[model samples]
Target chain A: MSGIQYLFPEYEVVRNDDRCIRCRVCERQCANEVHCYDEGRDKMFSDESKCVNCQRCVSLCPTRALKIVKSDCRLRENANWDSDTIREIYKQAGSGGVLLSSMGNPKPLPVYWDKILINASQVTNPSIDPLREPMETRVFLGKKPEKIVRGEDGRLVTDLPPQLELSLPVMFSAMSYGSISYNAHASLARAAAELGTCYNTGEGGLHEDFYPYGPHTIVQVASGRFGVHEDYLEAGAAIEIKMGQGAKPGIGGHLPGAKVGPDVSRTRMIPEGSDAISPAPHHDIYSIEDLRQLVWSLKEATGHRKPVIVKVAAVHNIAAIASGIARSGADILAIDGFRGGTGAAPTRIRDNVGIPVELALAAVDQRLRDEGIRSQVSLVVGGSIRSSADVVKAVALGADACYIATAAVLALGCHLCRTCQSGKCNWGIATQRPDLVKRLNPDIGSERLINLLTAWKHEIKELMGGMGINSIEALRGNRKMLRGVGLNETELRILGIAHAGE
Target chain B: MKRVYVNEEWCLGCHLCEYNCAFANSGARDMVSALKGKPLVSRIRVEGDGRITYAVSCRHCTDPLCVTCCISGALRREDGVVRIDRGKCVGCLTCVLVCPYGAVAPGPDGAALKCELCLQNSCGAPACAAGCPNRAIVYEEREEERS
Candidate 1:
């Protein structure tokens, strides 16, 4: 085999001989096959070169003897001709291919949430204790009737359209089955079911075992339209029309042939081991009017039983985009920001494209309210809503709910190694390898997810209580409670918040 | 020598480490008495903004930059744990600027507070590891280097 290495291996695995138990938990847990037992020497050895510093082997090592350290090796330090850029050059020269990266962009971008402050009641208003008062986090997302209806017989008519009722103002974002492990999907499904919230099935299609979670699932139909059928359409509580993603923006996604195992192939309704690449844009949709057509068509296909959500990336013209989406006969709009994670994407696009979710959400919400179409649809904001404070800020910025994935992954023991594309996820959340997949117990994963969300819900209640807002509805679009600290006039104008001490 | 190490994956960012550390060094019998109205400026801190969170404290580097950068002779290393002398001299923040982890910060009293491994006032194991709810923080030493 012709050997060509572009990037230096970042981690070196250290195995202790005296503490070796030979249980092979590390061997079984690693998808890269770094660890192996030599029958001739009867000893456990690791190649070390295959390590990604994911800490899978180190965490699973029974004897606690395994550790990974950053390689001290370096290329001559130059800022412009940096090691990473040089390595990329070498790799592209060798393979003549674009460098693909996984997870969110790690660049130091300005996060607007930290720049915004939430106002707490002092003398003018008294902060209510969440423990003593009822705070409503429950939300119904759909087109609400402009006014209460009255029947001809004088009996009050309660007939209304279908809405997605959430126990809290948070839900699991779309992470495809092909991108994450079966156990991860199962954990999300179980957690959503137990929490009475919804989990999205990203373009990869829904799994068969998770049909019991259909009532809490939001199935997506992307440009590729994988695993989509009449039953698949009707199986979910809501259907999402994914026009674009925040990670790649203008670019589409491609699940490699190697990741398309038997189960992923079946669920995706694609031939096994074949590359599945979604096109940049839906062939049928070229304009906002075309998007409306598709939205109504999905509504017709599902007999208008399930709400149709139009999901898009937060791009430069997001306000205009959301305005059109509001008129698209869709019930909800899901906007994912730039810091969103991906299974894999060209490194250039992930780190360089798209705007922040906070700015996009505020702009869209303001535009819709200005256009007097705010009640026409619901908005769910995602991408880097890390804490309950993030959720409260998102709601105050005019989001109906928040979608979180990275935080959910953290609850399931992910170390944020950002090696999700390697498919050797030691935590078993993002990998498909059976060995690594089995390492994550669905029961435990779901419980941890529930615990994280429950804690966040309590925190959200406290934050709302401090604002003197007893209900989430009262907090939604309540911009008076938010103030900007270090943002400029334009930034504050876009966010619709006054300066701190204003 | 045992030093405070972290498995940041298990850290829930609960900030209990800071409370326990202050209480242990406060010489107060209970937590409420030690930290009732006084805003705490603990040696160890958790630093993160949303996407990924991790605990940050003294790594006690063999050749610590903070010790070298300190002009007031306030920062020092003893027995492998980086210790701070708040009363030595000035509140110059050179160590805070030099520390890579952003672990060193100006305390409420204008003195720099950095993790001292709970050695100045305690006898038992470090209070942080003992009070960590998730056991994400631990006091341990490196494995023996193999030939």
Candidate 2:
């Protein structure tokens, strides 16, 4: 009872008098009962603690009439912060724990956007107008062996694995159905069909509506394996086994029961309000051999019609890891870099862990080639692939293509506020609330996404044409065509490319 | 004691809340036709500086003044939530004029509109709180009574 006063402490709005102006806007705008104008007092009176900081009064202040600030109340810094910290602090303060937030990166790390540079064609080589030349931006994603020999029957069949034929190199990455709204998933699926690429159904499994777009979907099976079944397995063009995510490296997701709506619950194969926890480690696979068992099991379950992709978070010795993945009978290997997006992850994991996609791609390509198993599997890289240059760079560095999540969301009008964790997405891109779901027009969203990929495809083809490469196959692993500028000797050596102007 | 509050610094001005609130009140089973081309004015509003935004809703004050401010007694505080009596409201606009926080607004019916805490309009919990992915509009009651 002692802290009740502190928890529901009366809010007041105090003016310094030196900055007082009777604009009367605060009186007109405040949606809380903290402020009042007593005709007897003739001055605006406020109980500051009740202010929710909606800023209505602050913005409407004609002469800067008001400022609403939180009271400077401090809790003891225990250093060992936990739920107990919150309970104890609330017990002491006597009110509900205050919710505070910050969006995007919570860790200090180098953003390669500053390190990477874009090359524009100058007077030396002619930059063709994109409207004139018919650029070929078509990209195929799958395993390409060292050789493709014809059988005695005269049919073109060899030891190469099945691949996904993408109209464009860019495709949406795995974002769980529960993590984002149904409308968002619908938009991606519709866009993938219209644009002739694919969108991944993250570990959350595919919604029933997306079954029509199954041909253009890459369904994922993570450690949790929520919606894995015979029907779910056969519903997509390719199956991706997610070893890790870019944002929350080394950690798994916990879809709080609060967010697991009835539809989400059904899709994820869990009860409503039960925490859908995904463990960091897969209970079945302990080694590369064990991984191969799961791979073959999925292949057997799906009757070998669909290509299986093993996606891993980029880490040290990734090249060695890729070599093992190749021999594991996987059709494709997807390496997620550190800068990928997630629905909800601890502030520490999203920013602190994982390696750069560029570095991981280079190492994995070199390792597989050095092991002579490069032909055994294909590679797709993700985390954050922004533009056509990233797609081209990925191809040259041994990736068959690239997977993009944030960029796809951007095409659907996401501002990258990194507030996806908040279910109140004004853009209707994230959140499962029926009201928010209505905000997204799947038809419009899908079209915009298709338009963006189509635009990027043209740009990619133009770049490839300038390099005298007619097909994506010729450009794959052609690092000689790539030269680095502003990179140190170690980076150049690792990337197996010479410095620009060398 | 459960209530809705807004933190201005984090609001992205996406306006999903408004759409959600409108849909919850629209009474349509499908969302597309209910919201596609309507002038959406929610009981709650987002207010902020040009660079930042936060949502605004009724505080459901302990001793509600809007109920008293109503000249026709159209406004009443029920179960800690402020409600408007549309049938009784004569469109005098007295409640709208006298509200200290501007929480009361003229609805389409010419009656005052304020946050009902989604007691009747919301499908489940308050749509704003249910839809807030960030757990921002928490609907938990305080444990103790005020001094």
Candidate 3:
């Protein structure tokens, strides 16, 4: 059978003769069969083709004599219709086999920055200078409910729901410890506390080390319900019932045993690897009533202290589904659009399954308002809420707050190569490998995340101030202050905003 | 005879091989606690610009000079695999200065360590190849492109 080359061209281990100390560390430490000892030659012979560029031998040599560089190779290039560089390499190597990779979207698509122009305050309404004015960045996420009346004893308290109090509108989305690493979870937990918001412990149960950040954590209960005991239920201020995710809407995730070490297995309540599969749909939740039962069960289990959030992917019929969710007794409704992040997922589902958050949020908001149930529950949208502008746009479309994952990672120095499913994060934010995990300094990661959110919060405050709004509460559903620049009549109608220059 | 090969296109650039390489070389008992939230020191690396990524590690070549470059005889090729002797390593990083692939790295104890193909602990295979989710990096007796 024809196959890729069995061996690369032999590379010479070049050394600076001026720097040679005759240290034997390189011969003793190399893992590949690259180095050879020839007693007759009285010198070590190096085969360069075998070197992997790990830099292990280089760092270990006391005499500093080792250096591994890539051998010179040329590629045939035809810019006219050649596939991607990776695809071409695979074609050359795998004989034209379909190349597979793990985690998030890799394709370059159109970013809506220029398409969605930001409305600035001009002569009509003066923009409030954040330096001089009190710009409120506070946001509440949960059911607003109806009717808060005074009791017979004259103390104000009737029937208002629980909400997540945020000093800023942005939050850390659900990224499991098992999916990333224990240190990754710790960094998120600490940053959440520092930012006065919440970091989610995804389907992976809360690690014991993070229980102290209970006040700033959102514990998720997916269909698998891994490590979801009564304690895990009560450990967070809010409970998010993950119905589906944008990355793989109709599919569940499987953390292979090779990646699931002892700690991840214990925390997730699954055998080490063993194909931890979370089915596409909740077997028990067959109907709206069934969803209501689960929602009430969680609230009852936590004595109503924690608000229950129903997290659903933004599918085509999201408006109707959201209307049902609003009536299902959930305190918050979190909709994930198609472009969400995941540790691993099928390629087809990530790019094709769910709808855009913009459309879904607008539709859901319109439906709930039309049904007079807008006050029943709060809304949170995820699946690539990229920047402060996206957050503001979501709020204009009736989202209370936004859940950010990729942005959070970017803050922590993630280049968004989308290889998270491989479980080896070069930056050490993801992956379970002890050595790779150490690459991420949690103190630095947490502080960087805090900085990102802090800066975004200030930007959000400035945006709100320009609209003549002092608080996020005032901006909620206040679409009159927004004017669409490039949107069509339908887009403007759906967004509940007037056309520009109207 | 021992070698490492990467299926570049299949490589997701996740860097799991790097972590696995680092952990396998760390000599730590608890993998999770050792790796959690720490800066990485892996013997292998995922190489690529933003648009393309692939795992790059030691290939364990037929004729090796890293062994010849070691003045202390700390690096040796036994049978078909390259092995590092930490006891004699003075942490002078001489092998690092010579190898073309940049494969040699420092150990946790400041000694020289490279991909030993997971032979020391007899994990049966290289940890990076075993742990890679995409099967991008593979360890075998010969580098044959499998269809």
Alpha-carbon interface RMSD for all candidates, in angstroms: 16.4, 16.9, 15.1
Q: Give the Cα lDDT of each candidate.
A: 0.85, 0.73, 0.75
Runs in model 2 lying further than 4 Å from the true structure: A1-108, A113-132, A153-160, B1-147
Question: Ranking under DockQ, best-scoring first?
Answer: 2, 3, 1
C-alpha lDDT of residue A451 in model 3: 87
What is the C-alpha lDDT profile of model 1 across B1-147, one tens digit per residue? 777888765564546677677778788776556665466657777776633456788777877899999998888888766888899848888888998878888887788888777777763678888766445788887773221
- Cα error, residue B82 of model 1, in Å, equals 52
Clash counts for all predictions: 0, 19, 95
Across A79-109, the per-residue lDDT of candidate 2 in tens digits comes to 6674334644665466454322213343446
Candidate 1 chain A weakest ten by summed lDDT: A20-29
Specify the highest-lDDT model's number.
1
TM-score of each: 0.74, 0.64, 0.66
Tell me which of candidates 2 and 3 scores higher on lDDT: 3
lDDT of 1 by residue, A413-496 (tens): 888888788887877788887645665777678999999999999999999999889999999999998999999999999999
TM-score of 1: 0.74
Residue-pair clash count for candidate 1: 0
**Per-residue error at A85 for model 1, in Å?**
2.4
Candidate 2 lDDT score relative to the true structure: 0.73
Per-residue lDDT, model 2, residue A70, is: 49
- Please say which candidate is ahead in DockQ: 1 or 2: 2
